[model samples]
Target: MAEWGSAWSTTPSVGSRVVVTGAAGGLGRELTSVLAGLDVTVAGIDRPGTTGTSGVPLIEADLTDDAAARHAVEEAADLLGGIDALVGGAGIVDTIHRADTFPLAAFRADVEANLLAQFVVAQAAYPALKAAGTSSLVFLSSIAAQDGLPGQASYAAAKAGVLGLTRSLAAEWVSDGIRVNAVAPGLFATPKVLAMPASARDRLLASVPLKRVATLGEVVGSVLYLLSPAAGYTTGQILRLDGGAGLTLGGFYR
Candidate 1:
């Protein structure tokens, strides 16, 4: 085996073309801004009323709709000359509800936003990714999938589906030179998260082995690494950025 030296870069190639979904959201907007500053051309797809970020082309579309998602991705590809990477960040976590009483419609909505939408966007970007001869697709999952947070049945189920989808796509698209992976983030210090009541934040922090929440930069760093040449040989893997929180979960003895 080769020695662990700087054989490759952990950053996206300068001038690389990237597409981001859910660009209007906090994480998506942050990611788009970071990519734009990295010399990579970026285009974002979000809901129709989202305000466009400066320096990033934002295309409004209903990502859960197959036709609309495909059209938006194709338009982004056309504008960028082709696509080198795609970040499927569009998803929704509905208000917490008990599984027994969770509306079927709400469950479907979560599955549609978190699972089906990701698949559709990936399908739409396949041609461009294949044409690039080497590309990366990163999906956002959640630690809830593993820890099974209470009142998050639908969100957890949808995120678990994302894991399955990531692996399947990685296997099917390996020959096409497309790499697929996912990032499962735990409680991160986003605006909304940081604004939580002190007691709530403390409760969350107590569960994390690190005794703290992850920074948005750290989560973004994971995505960036997976999309760069350094992770070229890595695919179908889920990188859990939960600060060892997964270890705190109880395990079945049987």
Candidate 2:
């Protein structure tokens, strides 16, 4: 087995305070676990009623609420002594609904949950990130953003917004030594996807040229890379971890 702790110590030093939002979910929890094992102080923010994995300080707050997001950032900065990286991973995938008939309320909720929440969190962390110097901001987008997945209008729109945010912030903060970027994950076997019917799951898998869904580890590796000095020169880029699904044109004319 790989020595997780030793491996992390050999990686480039990038301060220590690493704050991850939505640390209760599968990907979020896994990322938190990995960071914690590296001996980095991690502070997580989830919904007010949600609970995160054990052994980490999880602050209860809703990212959609600007005040709550600010509070979470402040609390995390206080707990960790400073903020070195901000991982915007909290998101929601609502029930699919036809665009024409999709409730406007649901659409708004989706946008707020996915895109706006990231914005709020980033804004809240800006000062702390600047203070830390050489900090990184990682946003979680989705393949749906670039693929225009049917029945995912809201999700696509929100995730696309994240790409825009990533690029803009990368430019805006470069002089300040803060790097900003985003990760667009392809279909992964998370709890959410695994709960789908077998037929539905198989159909989705067939769309990927790789013929399989991505593992959470693959996706998280991209995030870690961006935050590490290995990607010191990389910024304003949207790294896609989608098993080649984004390149396929099979569903374009369907």
Task: Supply every candidate's count of residue pairs whose N, Cα or C atoms clash at under 3 angstroms.
Answer: 0, 0
Candidate 2, residue 220: CA error in Å?
1.3
lDDT per residue (tens digit) for residues 146-171 in model 1: 66768878999999999999999999
Which ten contiguous residues of candidate 2 have the minimum total lDDT?
Answer: 6-15
Off by over 4 Å in 2: 1-15, 250-254
Using Cα atoms with residue i matched to residue i, what is each candidate's TM-score against the true structure?
0.94, 0.92
Candidate 1 lDDT at 106 equals: 85
The best candidate in terms of lDDT: 1
Q: Candidate 1, clashing residue pairs?
A: none
- Candidate 1 overall lDDT versus native: 0.88
Cα lDDT of all candidates, in order?
Answer: 0.88, 0.85
